[model samples]
Target: MEGRNGDAVSLLERYLKDWADESLHAKLAQVFAATNMLQDSLSHYQAALRINPQNEAATADGPKHIETTLSLF
Candidate 1:
């Protein structure tokens, strides 16, 4: 994010307010994940998956949430 992580997240979230596209959710999840917001990231990934099970990114990343959650226990 080149030190603009907050901006990236803010812009993505703003875009999401207008667009319910799975791609947007997937991207936001990616951003959140990069920022160490695992819960938010996982939730967005799940949201993307819900909208489109075929979303490659969501399918690939969403499952990581399970692994992360398990690691916490």
Candidate 2:
């Protein structure tokens, strides 16, 4: 990303278009979080949970991260 000057968000979004897996969504959520795209991150996290209610990471950390992100706004 630093070398190519490419948009990481766009790349992730493109990958999502092809596959909508829970793990992929979780990964996208982390990438979005790293980029400060909180809303998008939260959405992906929620999507992951919707796909698999037992998703431990999303279930445990999603709400906390969402709260933290909203607090910034």
Top candidate when judged by TM-score against the true structure: 1
Tell me the deviation in Å of residue 15 in model 1: 0.8
lDDT of 1 by residue, 1-73 (tens): 6468789888989998999999999998888777777788888888998999899998884558645774796
lDDT of 1: 0.83
For model 1 the local lDDT of residue 46 reads: 86
- Candidate 2 colliding pairs, count: 0
* Model 2 CA deviation exceeding 4 Å by range: 1-8
lDDT of 2 by residue, 1-73 (tens): 4422236667767887998888778777777777666787888888988999787767776557676869878
Clashing pairs in 2: none
- The lDDT values for all models are 0.83, 0.75
Residue 17, model 1: lDDT of: 94
